[model samples]
Target chain A: MTDRAPGPVRRIFTGPQRLAPHLAALSESSEYGRAIHNADPPPCDAPPWPEPHGGTPGTGLPRPDPQRSAGQALAVVRSGALTTVQDLGRYGHAHLGVPRSGALDPPALRLVNRLVGNPEGAAALETTLDGCAVRPRRAVTAAVAGAPCPVLVDGRPAPWGAPVRVPAGALLEVGRVVSGVRSYVAFGGGVAVEPVLGSRSTDLLSGLGPAPLREGTVLPLGPATGRAAPVDGVPTQAPPAELVLRIRLGPRDDWFTSAALRTLATRVYRVSAASNRIGLRTEGPPLERAVSAELPSEGMVTGAVQVPPDGRPLVFLADHPTTGGYPVVAVVAERDLPAAAQAAPGTPVRFVAVRHRSSG
Target chain B: MRALPVGDRALLVELADGEETAAFHAELLRRRAAGVLPPVREIVPAARTVLLDGLDDAASFAAGLDGWRAEAPDARVPDTVELPVRYDGPDLAEVAALWGVPAEEVARIHSAAEFRVAFCGFAPGFGYLTGLPARYAVPRRPTPRTAVPPGSVALAGPYTGVYPRSSPGGWQLIGTTDTVLWDPARVPAALLAPGTRVRFVATAAGR
Candidate 1:
């Protein structure tokens, strides 16, 4: 999906008003992270909005495929819960301020996508805490990823992270629980919806994309080859029941007292219930900054551990704003993004620092 | 003069040079030419200093910034951009109300002079427009609405900008123009780039 288009990729989006630049300046001054380009003409897996290919900004949750439009789309009906469209994220176009709001878990989402031959960054259903049951109006291929739940397709146990075939009117049910905050169900070919802002990922706060799925909402499906073959590059390493994420120090790291920076490297923290896609708030020893100035705003990036006036180091995540004013003491490596993406609330998180001596 | 940590990947650069901002900018430019600090993501220059981003970590990057402060650069400026605007906005009257002057007079003052686009941020395609006329300096709204429609011309606290899309914003709405400030399809979706000269020409329909 490299060099795809002016799609949704996580990058720094400059808002027209003073708030953006103000945040950018603060991000720089505080050593939070650089202003990544949300407007990455082509997409990468990084957040901000990482939807591959440009998306059409749909006003509401996309309607199900045309077959369901006759009366009501009935491929996958969530009996008691809400189902919303998700993708890896709307990649690129952050310069225009689009967010890479997509699947909370990238490896799982990509695993589901490859199992069904859908675009790796295609939009799927990111079902939260509870499970959803579907009544397929027609036959299609799909797979569930993350929060590994008990999914029954055609009344038989459906294997996870692998594609399964369903017949028309076949009831597909998911009821398994495992690690992670969200789960994704990608279909063969892919979820066919009007691409919005170069993504199908719904931005709850932005109001720029579609709404969540409700009862009777029919999802449109693009034609598929009917193959459930698992594609390569999908990480098969099971998500650790517990996780520890490694990180690097910040650019302007001197804001913190030397002892505080040392504490960060040696600390072992756990994700608080308050953590979400926006940021990871940890319950650990608070590090005191050297100076307490109401700093100006500056650029912010994913995995930036920004400590606000309260002194708690808030690790910015996928949906974090393009910029902020808090001083960041560290950043997670690009290679470890998947680990950060799969971090659920209450998950154990430790920051291991790696020093880069490169002058370039 | 002073150096600080901006983020994990950048350094807040201040230079000992009287032209501190330019000196840091020159050093960055030289390094870019020399391909030494490849991780420097964004380098924004101000009157006295520049902010650098894209450092691998905060500690080592800060060390480099400190060295630059001591070794100042001989001076040069980067290219600046120029932007065009139509002065007619819905809040023009409200803004003039604060000044106790006629709305048309405010327009005259706004278009009569030029302003610099200090930075690009807040939303994609949105520019942080600083350098407002002294009389027009106003604070932000006490309570911000949950949603402000896109293209709504707004001003707050000595700054003026347009909402690119519907979003949670605090700026007071002035007037709106049909300019597509951000279109991902365009080469440079952002209508206003940094360091651009701007002039607002009154338009009948935009009003």
Candidate 2:
């Protein structure tokens, strides 16, 4: 009699009982979910992420089929504190005074893009402390990563890090971050803004690419080339409770006194409210300088920790100028900058000087 | 010449003066164009220093610098841009007073000297040009203008520049030009990249 029962009725009774095993396998063998969680620390000698690929062809990495166009659009409902379209970044134009502006928390943006089956360098929306909301003209798969935050679709609770399908005209709201300072939102196809200098990133310093999102902004979407990843969940590193930055001292270290160097390494500092895309300013004891002469403007890297006359340290970020006049007493390691990007104003910061790896 | 370590992937090479900086920068550019330079991300020159960034091994590069010599840049003709300017700036009279000459003389003196882009900074496509003698250098405005019109020809310290766009600036404006100094749509966007030569030609349209 039980075997003869209709297949639909029998499956309903057994499906609930069989869910645990499927869930277990998902957590155990999900490749897309585990890749970032188990990834090794980037090599110290590796160039900063989103390396300048200006005028270069596509990354040649496997990408979703470009023929499948997702002719849809996203209407911004809430712009939040600050939201900008970003991709990996613009590179190779520093000689023209162009900054390599891109996502500050690149790993987060990359992960979100991956969840949506977009190229890791696909353009996405980077929101500040306050999250944003958008309504898609067509149903699409989307993912949000970076600062942990509550996500809502049409006012109903939704998963934050996993890809979720939003119905056409449904409101996808990224709530204020529960922690951390920024969040990333990616669609199956990236935002289709016109590229400037080989990137879609909005460089606040040089005023390149698209402008910051406005409430009524309408953004075009590229075609969705692939299906979203099958993972039910993604694990992300927790935002640092006490931001610890690894740094290498030099170039202009001789300008600072030995005590100043000690102060930088040992003293506790907090992120300043004045921080912006150009730099992460710190509020703490000023470093004393041995030489007071003005530094001739010189090329500045993304992670340079420059010291101004105020004696405070200003760590250059993605949107930093290609050249600066202030002496850079040290430079934060590139890998550490992702965490720095997520650090909110007033977060405690510690700069730890790491010795250069001697040639083996 | 001094090559100092900047973190793990960059070096700041300091030269004796602006001429030396230009010469060294030109040499680096020549090597890079010839594909003899090691892979590098950027070669940025400033007043007295050149920054080499994104090197595979900054230490090894710095070590190699001891054997390198910067030849006086080749005397080959450089890319030159001619900007026609109308001497009708609000500060033209003040600049004339500073030069101890008539307002008309200010335009003549400025238009006569040839200039070279020393460096680029402050904003994209904005070049710091050098050619005027140190005695002719002018001080920046005591208080910068909230908005300097685009294409305004200006001078401050040892550099002469044109506003690529309307932005806050302190340079003393001496004239105006219609030439676009920067346009992203154009290949090689900046009209005055470092080492490019420039000349200001007086337009017959205005005083």
Candidate 3:
């Protein structure tokens, strides 16, 4: 595997109707935002691996040995919080028993890139529950998207959505759980990690590739060096109580009885404490299947609602399993993933069925 | 043939011929290696379908089914893989007790024949190997385990498999081994691919 630096990953938003500019804007780089556009890195060592169930604390955000950097771009993950390298996801190998696990809130990940003027698909630090203390090795523009974290740069409060710059050796801190569960921090120079399988996201379930960020892991950084585009704003946490996630009927929507579908459509489902990125388990009235015949296991996409014998439908989030036997009654649209990702445990979540396609 | 839009570059093809799914997937793999597709990221072959995702559009891609469905009817399938396992797990004792048979006899019946990796699912690394010996086959536990160890040999319904990783399961464990069930780092991650043959061997060591 050749060790080449990668290009800035392109982020594709599903819709043109942008929601209100988010609270925290990503800081790709001040003025000249192009520093985040990375070059297409040549192939590196990507071996087939075991499923990683959970990220090891020691390896959470940093690499033991500093990655070979391509340009002057350098960033350091600081103390506290859970920050992991996330690309889109590990794909194709699902048949080989890999989960397409990555960002639970993709829109946030994409927005993080756009904020810093980086391509959306670029690997960024996904901070879950808690965020990290970030330090830039150089004066580079960066942005924070997704979760409602009270961000401070060098002891001064930093705005969340728009891009901001940190001088070399400056201390950047992000406080936890202002509203949502996950936060994405994108550097003007995208965070650089060796791609395992097809992505940079650490597959904790498949015990393959680099571990999640750990202390003393100074990650490799990439330099895009692109001209700054006019910055659009970032999206922040909406009113948590009134968040309504959009849903798309699945191919197997007929598997459930009409009453069951109606109950799913109208009844309130509460996010159980067991919910996480792997999948969201809900506490709701148990669903009953119309037929007892076991359905064949099939491929699933993000947002699939699969029901088991117990009738509890698992709303598969970003790190969901490859395939499932439960019939998927519905799927949450891309537009609604942010809200779904923000569904705090025990948060009352109500599913409303809608006829929406991916309106890219 | 139906073309479902995901976002832009990706497309899903619903194949009616189960045999060709493998064949078309091989063709796509070759294409992927050759750099013919600038966008495709994933090429997923399911029971009777294939979903083509452009690397650039995986997040939001469209599946061009009309062309792919017509083209996939006679594609060449990939080769099958075979697997070996020991039909023993922790739950083997309970299953034998419920069936009024000794664990040794249970092992004999389990090793009697072969199975197929008909499907892969459940957890990340979990593969469904079908075709279990009728006598050894049993219903899943009424109450599932909160967590089952990885590489656990188990049987439930007409299926026998090794748990890829520790996960909640209802299958009866017969034995355990170090052989990884689902390893992503290894090529062909699932040791037992669909259409692959599987035979259980009784060994002196049972974990």
The Cα local distance difference test for each model comes to 0.58, 0.79, 0.60
Reference-based lDDT, residue A200, model 2: 74
TM-score of 2: 0.87
The local distance difference test score of model 2 is 0.79
Q: Chain B TM-score of model 2, please?
A: 0.97
Model 2 lDDT tens row, A1-360: 011110111111122111122222212212112211221211111222333333123321223232543337889998776778988887877877888989999999989999998778888999877788999988999999999999999999999899999998999999988888789999987887666766777876667777677677888787677679999978867667798999898778999999999999999999876676677888999999999876777888999998876899978888888877778999898999988888887899999999876422
Name the candidate that leads on lDDT: 2
Most TM-score-accurate candidate: 2
> B51-169 in candidate 3: lDDT tens per residue?
56444654332333224432443344444443445555667778888668987777777776656565565544455665665555577776667567777887776677677766556
Candidate 1 per-residue lDDT, tens place, A1-94, comes to 0011011212222221111212212212111111221322222223333323322223122334455444333455663233457775664444
Q: What are the per-residue Cα lDDT tens digits for candidate 1 across B53-135?
A: 55667566665554554364343443444333455655566778887888778766665655555444555566656667667
lDDT preference between candidates 2 and 3, better one: 2
Candidate 1 runs further than 4 Å off: A1-76, A79-84, A90-92, A196-198, A205-209, A230-242, A357-360, B1-105, B133-137, B147-149, B178-180, B183-190, B193-197, B202-207
Interface RMSD of each: 8.4, 19.4, 10.8
In terms of docking quality, model 3 is incorrect
Candidate number with the higher TM-score (1 or 3): 1
True contacts kept of each: 0.15, 0.52, 0.23
Find the 10 residues in a row with the least total lDDT in model 2 chain A: A1-10
